[model samples]
Target: MHTPDPHRHTPVPPVRPTRRAAALALAAATAAVGLVVAAQGGAGAAVQGSLAADTQFYKDPTSQVVKWVAANPGDSRTQVISKRIASQPQGIWFSNYRPDSVTSDVRAVTSAAAQAGQVPVLVAYAIPNRDCGGASAGGAPDLPSYDAWVGKFAAGLGSSRTVVVLEPDSIALTTCLSAQQQNDRFASLARAVTTIHAANPNAKVYLDGGHSTWNSAAEQANRLRGAGVLNADGFFTNVSNFNTTANESSFARNVLNALGNPGNLHAVIDTSRNGNGPAGSAWCDPSGRRIGNYPTAATNDSAVDAFLWIKPPGEADGCAAAAGTFVPDIAYQLAQNAPDPSTPSQPPSSQPPTSQPPTSQPPTSQPPAGNAACSIAYRANSWAGGFTADVTVKNTGSAAISGWTLGWTFPGDQKVTSAWNARVTQSGAAVTATDLGYNGTLAAGASTAFGLQATYGSNNTTPTAFTLNGTACTTS
Candidate 1:
C-alpha cells in the first residue's frame, strides 16, 4: 500500500508487481523462523494525545469519495458511506517533492490539528527504492535529496503532539535490494529518525516492522537496530496489511524482545483494514476484508502505544482501483460490513501456528479424491440497486477439502459487483467464488461463510444451484 516513486530514483527502476505466490513464500519462510528459531515499545512526550479527529475530509479534495458524494447525494448510500469515509483518520502522506513548500504544507496540517486539540499523524514515505520500486514507487531522487525532504518534513511539526509512521514496506521489502543498497537504506532510515526528533523534539517516530506474517521477529528486529530504532520512539506493525491486532500485538512483543526489550519502546498496530483478518494470503485489494479497531491510544498494553489508522479505508491497494486512490464504493462496503468493535470475535493465535503433519486431525475412515461432500446456502439483504449476501458452505464427507470453489448461475441479470472473505469472479450469467487462505481448508462435516454484494437492473434473484469445487451442493 505504501510505495515510493521509481521515476524519482530512476536508478532503482520499477520492479514487477509482487505475485501472490512470491509473497506467500516469503511469509511462509519468515513465519517458520518466528516459530522455530525462538522468540523475542516506548513512551515519549511528543507521542502524548488522542488521535486527532481524522475527519477524512479536506486532506485530499480530489479523492474519489469526494467526487462521488457531491455528485450522487440522492444515492441511498451517500450519507452513511460519505460520513464513514470522512469520519475516520487517514495518514497524511508526504510523497511528493517541493522542498520550498514541504515545511509549510506539513506545518499547516499539524497546526490545524494542534488548534483543535488533536495530534497530527504523518507518514514520511519519501524513502529511496520504496515498495521495491513497485506500485507506489516515488521517493527523493537521491540520499541528500531525501534527507533534505525529511528535514523539511520535520520542520513542519511545530511543537504539537505528533506520531510519525516513518515508512511502509521500506524495511520489510529490503530483500529486493542489493547488499550495498540495503546498508545505504538502513543508514538513511537511521538518520531520518534522528533528523525528525532533532527538528521537533515533541515528535514520536515509529519505524516500520512490516507485518506479523511477513517478516520474522528476529529478522525485522535486526533491521530495526541497524536502522537506528534505538534512537526512535518505537516501531509499528501491519501498516497496510490486514493482520489482526491480537497477532500484531504478540508479534510486536516478539520484535521488541528480539531487540533486547529496550525500555519505553512502544509499538502501534495499523487497525485500518484488519476487520476480517486476512482473506487468505490475498494482499492487494482482496474482497471481504473490513475495518478493524478505531483509532485509540488506550490499548491497555504498555508495549502498544495505540491502534492507529495508518492506512485509510477506501484507498485501493493497487489492484481494486489504483494504489492509494480512494474508491467510494470499496470504502462504503468495508464500512457497512465492519464488525462491532465491542463484540469479541475469534481471538487470533497467541503464538504463531507451527507447521504440522497433515494428519494432525484424525483422518476419516475412508478418504478418497474428489469424494468430499459439500453444500452451500445463501442469505441476503438489499436496498435499491445494491445488495449484500452471505454464503455458507458445509462439508459432509469422510475427507477434508484443502481448497474449494463455489459456482452458480444468477437467475436474472443480477451481478456481483464486490465481495469479501472470498475471491469472486463473474462472467455473463455465472459466478465463481473461491476461498481465501483463511477459509480455504474446510474439515469434513463443518461449515464456513463468505459474503458479497451485487447490483441489479430489474431483477436480483439469488442463484439457485451451487457447487463446491466442481461437485454440486445440495440446497437445504
Candidate 2:
C-alpha cells in the first residue's frame, strides 16, 4: 500500500453534489429541453447510464481527482480529468495508522455507499512492514498493533456490501523478513481476516496474491493458504501493479486450482493502469500506460469477481511523485492514451472511410477467408538477453471463435522460457500458443491477450506475421 502524502494534500472546496444527484439533475434538465434536444443527447446519456447500471461499486465524489477538479476548474486539463478519472469508481484507501479515528473514517465512506445501494471498495493497508522498507514503507510499528487497527477498520463496514483488499504486497514480498517473522506475519494476517469477518459477515475480504509476474502460481497459492485465504472471500492480484487483465485472470485461476478450489473463492484484478500492459517488471510510475478496463463486477469469468480500480489512475507509484500523491499530468496522459470508446473496433487503416464499405462488401460467391477475420497487437519490453511480450488477439469476424491457436515466427533467435494465459510451444524460430480452456471463446469484436517471457541472444526483433487457427492475421 502506498501511503498518502500529507504535505501534498490539496484543500478540497466544499463537497459538491454526489454523482447520482448530478446525474438526476441533468436528466431533469434534459427533459425540460423537450424531445429534439434530448434526442440529440440520447447517445451520451445512454453511455453514462449504461456505465452506472453495469457496476455495483460506489463512486466517491470526494476522491482525489474530484477535489483536484473542483479546486482547479479553470485548468485546461480539468474537463478530461474530471470526466475520465474523477467520474470512475475507485478504491478509497485507509492507509493511515490511526486506530482511534479509523472506525469513523471508514464508516463515512461505507455508510454513504450503503445509502446509495452501492458497494464500497476499501483497501485495508496498515499491515506491519508494508512495502518492506521500499518507497511505500511504514505500517503499524508491530503486528499486534496492526491486528487491533484492522479490527477498528472492520467495525466501519457496518454490514454494508463491501470489498476489502487486505494489505497489498503483504504475502508476496516477504523476503525481507526472517523465517519466524514471516510465520508471525502470516498468523497475524489470518487473525485479521477472522476479525473482519466476525465484525461484518457481509464484507468480502481478499488476501493479496501478488501479480502474475511476481511469483509462480503454485508458490503464490501456498503463500495464500498460509495467510488464511480459504476462510476469506478470495485473493486479489495486481493491486497497484500494471499487469494485463488476461494474464492476471489466468494466473489467478491457476492459483485457485493449486489451492484445491476451496469454498466459493474468487479473485479480483487491479486493472486501473494496465491498458498498455506492463513495461517489463517496472513497478513505478511508467510512461505510456493507460487506464484499463473501467471498474466492473460483470466479468465474464466465474473465477474472477471483478476488475477494480484499486490504484486510482492519477496517483503516482513513488517514482514520479511521493507515493499516492495525485498528479494531474499523469492523469491526463493515462486518460488521453486510452482507446476512444466510440471508435470502431477495427484498427485504423490507410484507406479512406468512403472506400472502406465498398472494399468490405466482398462478393457473395466467396466468403472472406479466416485469415482476414483476425488482428493481433504485440508489445514487448526488452533488456539485455531477455524480454516479456504481451500479445492481444482481436476477433473482427461476424461470428464467435470457440477455440483458437495462434502461431508466429520470430525474426530473431528468441526462445520462449515461460508463458501465462496460454500454453506456448516453440520449434526453432516458430512459436505456437493455444488457449488454456478458460479463455478459449472470443465473441465477435472481442479481444483476449496472452503474454510470454523469452530470451534472445543479440537482436530482439519482434515478429511481424501472426496467424490464428492456421489462418493469417493482420498485425500492428
Candidate 3:
C-alpha cells in the first residue's frame, strides 16, 4: 500500500477539459471505429458477442469460440490492429515477486519467443516503496537493491526480441510521496529503462500509465515527464489493472498531448482481461470479467501504437487467488466472459476477429542466422523443491540446427521447480522450454539433455505431450 506523508503535500489542481479533448477524441474514434476489437465492445453488458475464434484456446482449447471463428471468417471483428502490434518486436514486463531465480526462466521464454519471430512483452515492477501503499504493495528493499536487481534483469535479456513495460502505477500512484521520494523513484525508473535498452538495442521500453481513472492527462504527462518518459520507447496504459480500451486510449493520447509528443509517443493497452470492462470500478481480482483480446499488433487510431494483452488473462491480482498463480476457475470465468461467436442464422455477435490460424501452436525451434535447420531440445532444468528430470532432444529433420527451442505442457497439478541451461516460460498449462544463458546455440548432429527437479504431492504417470519450434514433436 502506498502511504503518503500528509504534511508536505500540495493540493491537486483541477484539470481543464480543453486540454484533454484531443486525447479523448482519439480514443473515442478507436472505439467508434471498432478498434476496440472483440465481443466485449457491444451493448447488453460486456462486449455482447462470442469470443474471437482464437480466444477459445484461452479457456479449453476446444471451446466454441475457437471453432466458430475458424468456421466463419467474415463475422469476427478483424484483429488487424492487434496483428500489427504483435508483429512489432517489444519487451515483456517482469515485476519482482517470485523468490526463485526467474532470470533464466523469463529469458528462456522471451528469447525463444523472439527466436520464433514474436516479441515477448515484459513488465519490471519491483521498485522500492512501489505503489506507495496502494492496492499493489511490496517491492525490492530499496533503490540500491532495486538497481542491482535490474542489473541481473538486464543480463537476462541475452539477445532475445522483446518489449519492456516498465513499472505500472509507479508514477501516478506516487502522488502521496514526498518530492524527494518521487524524484528518487522516477530516477531509478529512468535508469532501469536505460539499462535494459542499452543491454538490447532491439528491446522497446515503455513507462506505465495508471489507468484512465487514476490520473488526468496533464497530471499523467507531468508525472511521466518527471519519470523520464521522454527517454522511454513510449508509455504503457492499463497494465494488470482496470479501464476500458476507449477510456485508456483517450487518457493515453491526452497524456501524450500534454507531454506534447504526437505519433512518436505511442501507447499500448492491457487487453488481457478487459473484455467485459471493469466490474463497477473494482480493481482487485474483480468478479464477472472475461479475457480481453489476446495479444496482437494492430492499431487503427494513428496515435495509438497497438493493443496488447500485457497481463496474461486468468492470472489473479492477489485476491481470491494468489497473485500470479494460474487459477482454472479464474480462467473459466475469463473464458465465459469472452464474447460468444456470432452466426449468420442468429443475431449479430460483437466478438473481435482472431488472427491466429486454427491448430496453431507457439514456436519451439528457431532458424539459425543463415540456415533453415530445426533441431533443438528443450528441458525443465529445475522445479520448486529440487525435483528434476532430463529429456533427450533429437534433430528429427535433415536440416542442420543453429538455434533450437522446446515447448511442452505440464500436467495440471505440477508447476516448475527450477530450470537451467535455458529459460523456462509458462502460460497456463503450456510450457515453452528453451536454452538459457548456459546453453542456447545447438549443433544439428548432436543431442542435448536438459531437465528440472519438481516436487508434487502425488506421483507422476506418462510423459506430457510437447511441441518443438511451434511444431508438435513426435516420439521416435
TM-score of each: 0.64, 0.67, 0.53
Write candidate 3's Cα lDDT for 418-460 as tens digits. Answer: 3323456667656666753223445555565554434445534
Judge candidate 2 against the unseen true structure and give its global Cα lDDT, from 0 to 1: 0.67
Measure candidate 3: CA RMSD: 21.9
Q: Where does model 3 exceed 4 Å of error?
A: 1-35, 38-93, 97-103, 133-135, 340-476
Measured by TM-score, how close is model 2 to the native structure? 0.67
Of 2 and 3, the candidate ranking higher by TM-score = 2
Q: Show model 1 residue runs off by greater than 4 Å.
A: 1-71, 339-370, 373-476
* lDDT, each prediction: 0.63, 0.67, 0.50
Give the Å shift of residue 110 in candidate 3.
3.3
Against the true structure, whose TM-score is highest?
2
Instruction: Rate residue 247 of model 2 by lDDT.
Output: 63
Arrange candidates by TM-score, highest first: which order?
A: 2, 1, 3
